[model samples]
Target: MASEPPDAAAASRRDGGRPGGLRRMLRRLTASEAEIEAEELQRDVERHGCQPARQVERGQLVSVTGRLRTVVYTPRTTVPTLEADLYDGSDVVTLVWLGRRQIAGIEPGRALTARGRVAIRDDRKVIYNPYYELEAAP
Candidate 1:
């Protein structure tokens, strides 16, 4: 197969940035259902004080599932966080975006299954963290 033009890959990324179609596929292939579920249990994971990894030391490494709410990509800034609204028949959870390395596409209300540990951030329950980190995207 012919290799893509040198600029071809760069062009696609330039067109959609890092959070493009490719990112979404990677997230889908990596995230787990339990991870998403654990995310739903967060207590305002967005807040810096929630501290998922620190507070929830014994978080279970589960496979969670959820739906994307939004994805903001800023190459000039730092890692992209994939904001999402995750749910599990039991309840609806607001999943905060993870680091850029783990984040992927911005599905915006799309379903996802993530794999990670249960933790807390700013007094809230979270799936991913440095210690018991949560892999929301990929």
Candidate 2:
């Protein structure tokens, strides 16, 4: 029989009708983790300050050196493609080698420098058939 106050109704709507305290705290914690991860990524990219991957522009010929974070092979497609995600502290770039299943020495945890013109594919930055040099393990 009692009616909710105007402010309580507004707060409930803002919190999606859930109690705000714990839910808000959890949301804040999740956001903090994302912020920390992004900061770490930026710092890693900055270590290679000479050729920062974040500054690479579309269609610009660039030489970026970074550690391979992931290596994926897509053989189901008409053209087999080897895709690798390279991270240089600052940004992540996807490297795609079409018509190839694998390239020797191109694997996760490998350090490599790739030279190519930057392109955007599927809303992600990518380089196709880049000339790459595998770095000596440190």
Q: What's the TM-score of each model vs. the native?
A: 0.36, 0.64
Write the residue-wise lDDT of candidate 2 on 71-100 in tens digits.
999986478899999887678889999999
Off by over 4 Å in 1: 1-58, 70-83, 92-98, 101-104, 129-138
* Tens-digit lDDT string for candidate 1 (70-119): 44443435555544444443343335545643443435655555555655
Residue 17 of model 2, lDDT score: 85
lDDT, candidate 2, at 90: 73
- Candidate 2 lowest-lDDT run of ten: 41-50
In model 2, state the lDDT of residue 91: 82
lDDT of 1 at 30: 83
